[model samples]
Target chain A: MSETGVIHDIGYQRYTGPRLGRGAGIGALYVHGLRAAFGLGRSAKAKIFPWLVASVALLVAVIVAAIKSQFSEFTFSYVDLDDQLSWMIIFFVAILAPTLVSRDLRSNTLPLYFSRPLRAADYVAAKFLAMVTAVWLLLGVPQFIMFLGAAFTTKTGFKGVWHEIQDLVPAWGYSLLWALLFTSIGLLIASLTGKQAFAAGGIVAVFLMTTPVVAVLAQLPSTTANHLAGLTSPITLINGVGSWALDGSIGFDIGRYGPIYAIEAFCLIVACLLLLLARYRKVSAL
Target chain B: MNIIATQALTKTYGGGVTALSDLTVQVEAGVIGLVGANGAGKSTFIKIMLGLIAPSSGSVRVFDIDPVTETDKVRARVGYMPENDCLPPDVSAAEFVTHLGRISGLPRTAARERASETLRHVGLYEERYRQIGGYSTGMKQRVKLAQALVHDPDLLLLDEPTNGLDPAGRDAMLALIHRIGAEFGISVVVCSHLLGEVERICDSLIAIQGGRLLRADRISSMTTASDVLAVEVSDGADELAVRLTEMGLAVTRDHRMLLVPMDSDDAYDRILRAVTELELHLHRLDQRRHRVAELFTAKETVDV
Candidate 1:
């Protein structure tokens, strides 16, 4: 035996166990992306913004509930939950969409992801779903807390709770729609650049710039062109969808536009989805 | 069986620069070194084999599964350590490696278990919890390597694994790579432009130049000893060479050694007698073996 070439057993064990396939791989990315969206499993500084926004949003809900409990004759309900917190939702997503998607691209870690047992479509779907779920939680938690508060504090107690449940169900449904709408547009814009600040700024600009333009256009005698212009802003579309999904009404008088505005909003949603898919598809190749 | 095989693989980018052209090769299961200089198409070939990119006109197979068509299957069975730094700086090595292990289809508990084991094997156990942004370059490379091994894939494609390491770090990494292949029996293809390190660590070699296959063979065959014997003397190598030449032996003088053609049965006796007559102390004597640098010119004479 040669003294120099004797190989030492370094405990490099071969894995002979069961290995999951593509579905499990995609699930792992989904879970990892979900944690990243809220800045979990990262630096302490990374955890600050998302948690702060969540706390502030929840505090607002608590304060609102506290104020509502004072007046027994108050008829305030949960249907307007999204309206009160839409700006907060916008801010949360502006910070979060880039946190989930742009960091991977900016660090050029897509190749690390794509080189695994994951497909390009699966990766995009995982990121999109994570962002949607994040936005849902960001919006849903406060709504849920407020729902419990309103249910128990009412004068009629369980009866008021039963009545509030009826309204809360559709409000929950509207919040989900809000999640899908905001995440789709936010992730689509965030995927355009690898720079996180740029992606965040761009998302904020897209939301901030178009709202006034939509408001100005919606005032032009409620014309067909004006109603169509309302779909240009993602927030207006979210509001239109929320009103339609919750109260069966359309914002910016879009109902007179004969489903054209809704169709355009749906088309815009589809376009954002397709753009996100295409962008990650290109990244997977890199 | 060949773990990876490519048939006339070619790739051309948008700017009409050909990264690889007419490349055909087969790699067996062992520590195979890809020896080449920069821009020699080593990375392109690796990316193609990993199913990360498609060839312009050819096919590739990893363990007889086509990488282009069966990417998930191929990638599931293969681990890749890329040439570039591709780590998220905010995450610790433990979290990153475990997440990648799960992404490669290991169950969560097994992923975590294997992550620690792999990180320990890569000598990063002590600092696995530190954020990668604060890690030194060597630590970051080990993190990248740890992630690749966390899944325990059948094959590992390491592109420039020693790209930015100091000499000691490079030595430790090469030793770890050597042990991984020797002890665990996982096949490794270590891509490097340094001939000496590759020669030290790899069992087989594939040399390419200008995106073309220059030579592929067992490291032993490529480095077989030549017919010349190198003789080193303590005091006077020049005097030994002159005396050996005067004694009708074909000898040439190198810096501190004399090269003599060992042809006849009495060659050793003749050289010994000449050195004895000169009363010179012999330092060393051995047959001259070919080095990997000889492959550059050896290909011109031998058909690969």
Candidate 2:
């Protein structure tokens, strides 16, 4: 028992390495959100809905590829695959959007997030990018499968393969458009509520409830209303834009209102993103 | 240098509800306790320090950087554990903490290594792989703490670190916090309503009430010994009290004990002489010291 005291080193090391800045914070959040969207790095129970939707999507892509390879008369194009899987895309958005933003809101982890080197714009950007990437991969991967099916079945030489690549590139861009529009709208709706169930339900309702409005407006006996009807619902609006820009790939008639559809789509994405940023400016503490 | 400084900081919410008003305080390094009752603006103050919310007026700085303008620079060096339940139930603690570490600007491998180290430091190494939903309140609190410390921050803002824990859990958390501040050489701002816990681990105390600063001083200064002695007798307490009063001492009886003012140098000797003269059993004899709780009670009596 000496008078001198001993302060042992218990091996608590300090981090003196290079700490990344706002870019890294946003990148990490994007990666985390993307993984969480597909229920990666989560529990088995948490993986059920996402995997269920994904497996069905993959199954449809496989069947479409098989049917196209078997019969040359099968008229399913790469872009048409998106149109065919639009319902699955909607379901995927409903499941994925809440997992991206609503879980953070429900768990009240925004304070922990914002307490780091992350700003509100960075958070919204990272999450928006993550959802867009997730949705794009959901459509893009399957479209690539369809491309492979068509590429393998082509009797012509490199020209046919080159033609398939052109169609596949535009279709990938179209899927990106779907990802952008659906993710913005889905995230905006999901960001409003902390309950994932309510968020998922509200997203589906907003997307579903507007289709009837488009139908009623389309049957108004006026050609202008019929041509402009797709602008009412997000699904038809995307289809309208795709048909207009992608050279009538989707048969929905936009008539002379093609530019209007494009303008509306751009404005809708920007508006939703702005609203999402505003919603995160002041997060409610639990 | 002061780790945090605020000058006339005020935050007035919409509908005329003020959360903080003119809160001017400078906090140096060490384990500082922010003690206040509910709705006493403790959380509001911490939020302003973390730059989570903008102050309506006045200016604040952390590490010489204004949090409003240089929030990222300030936040890069500070770690925050919010008061509420912020853990997602679906993810394991290790994954969640490592993700948060990356968000705090650590590299991928460094984040993972530090997450494990901090979890171990908080005594949560074995259970780090379990999902947070199955964790007890104490274990969840440690997970929150691990996330805050994963980046090896210079400052830690812990809002109620021992909140919702059993007695043993509380003592363990307090000891962990003490070790973090004393051994790891990190400045900590622990926001708690329990004054006793604050007094036990805090080097300095800042008590706020109604969004105003009540007192800010060292814990030793705040709880100095008072000029009074407490004596408990197993028997003949009343006779000792009477004898002490007859001998020109102000004695007050409280239950089976007597409180006597130590105004003279021989006060202890005089009390002992009286106890011996009365043949009373000397059960206990000690000096009374002031506690942090007295500040609130003293304020209440003045307001009344």
Candidate 3:
């Protein structure tokens, strides 16, 4: 007999419930189901997602509108629509998955897990993976459409497929990388403050508000826009990625994409370490 | 050997608030009561044992595993229930418990099965499948308990499991705890501010105050109490025990009152004579036995 049954004497044979086809426990599946139904439910989705979709959609429309107008010979094609939606998908996913990571902490659901047999690092890892998977599904489906669209529209269908494969690697890789980074950063903020909004805001503030603000300030006057300064933040790293794909290099003349990847990797490692530290400090004190 | 032992465990929050202080306790393999006033360090002690917080100046071990250095192994042996209300309303009891079990390293099927059975034990059968947000407070507490027990630990740390319940709910919860500790053989560390509640269920008790150990002893070993005694005396409290013992009388202290057994009625004069010689203050010498509550309440006042 398992120790849990003997200790609890609940008496139903352990694991006698409805089974999960996958090797993972029904517990994880149950959590995923609850998240899909309520976490990504009617009330919250409309409020958070439309804005995400709209912003990404607008950016894509502008780029498409500009290209169509600038070069008269370039035909208006369905592949462009695919690319636009794909970007929107990735953008929404990058922002949304980390949003819930902070929410769980603010809600006090974390202590429940800690009181059980799980370790602090395990808890952080589970949450991290859960959030990463959410973003992957949200973005991966839409982005794959570009591959299919190119086959239907362009004369060089194989070339379109090649481009899709090339972009696919980066898009998927970045999604996971960004998910880990965001989750780590968001979790660090969440650990610092129990409030969900504050943690979420910290992520946006670092990525959207602070980095650009500093970059723009550097561009102004006797610019502190120094290379050392520009390379200091999460947003700056994202900016470098944006620059790499768009122009085959960053405007800052930063040495290749290697430095950017290295910076992101460093941030992710630190974020994970911080998460474990916070969990231990909190658990030890609980 | 002690399964859990602490040496002067103390915790001070950042704002100069001391949650626990100098609380030294040893818990073995049975039901043990951790009785104290609210804000008395029960939660603090539990947290420190699980390595949730560092003590200001103390050490702790849960199952011989230092909570800090061997936290994972230590946690594996402990099933903990917090006092506060903390359940995700959207998730069902079974789902919440299953997730916790999986996180504890149980296989998926095992996690789900345990979730089902544990919820049933806590009296949340089919309802375990329903959303927790829709359940009542009593139901919610059951979910909290289920999650704690999902891992099948050796020792269960229950921090006021009946904190906000009504009388019936409290009784039901207490009965379940007794079964877990005595019948199922799980060592229970139950903490509560209510002395009466702990006295009724615990075989041994460790009382704490301001983070210090006030007392620790088996309920029977600690107190000097005798069986039913009936004595008619002018002033006979301490002598009553002697007179009864000589004539084989059951004398016991139930607070300020001293009881002499009716079987020792033949030595009533001796009881009276000894009482006068000792110059002891006599309240009432009754045949009726006194409950543990009166004893603890009186002792608590005297200690304070």
Top DockQ prediction, candidate number:
1
Categorize the docking of model 3.
incorrect
Q: Against the hidden reference, what TM-scores do the models get? A: 0.91, 0.92, 0.71
Candidate order, DockQ descending: 1, 2, 3
Candidate 1, residues A246-273: lDDT per residue as tens digits? 5555354566553554576678778889
lDDT for each residue of candidate 2 in B1-304, tens digit (9 for 90 to 100): 8988899999998889899999999888999999999999999898888877789999999998998888888888898998899999877899999999999888999999999889989999778998899999999999999999998989999999998999999999999999999999999999999988888899999989899888888887766655578999898888888899999999998787799877777999999999888888899998875567876689768876
By lDDT, the best candidate is 2
Query: Which clashing pairs does model 1 show?
Result: none
* Candidate 3: tens digits of C-alpha lDDT, residues B257-296: 5566545445456566666666766555554434555665
* DockQ of every predicted complex: 0.72, 0.62, 0.22
Candidate 3 error regions (>4 Å): A1-99, A151-164, A174-237, A245-280, B7-24, B55-59, B222-224, B227-304
**Model 1: residues >4 Å from true position, as ranges?**
A1-10, A72-75, A154-159, A248-252, B227-229, B233-235, B246-250, B261-276, B281-288, B301-304
Candidate 3, residue A48: Cα displacement in angstroms equals 9.8
Can you write out model 2's per-residue Cα lDDT over A164-240, one digit (the tens) per residue? 99999999999999999999999999999999889999999999999999999889999999999999999999899
Regions more than 4 Å wrong, model 2: A1-11, A284-286, B225-229, B242-252, B260-278, B286-288, B299-304
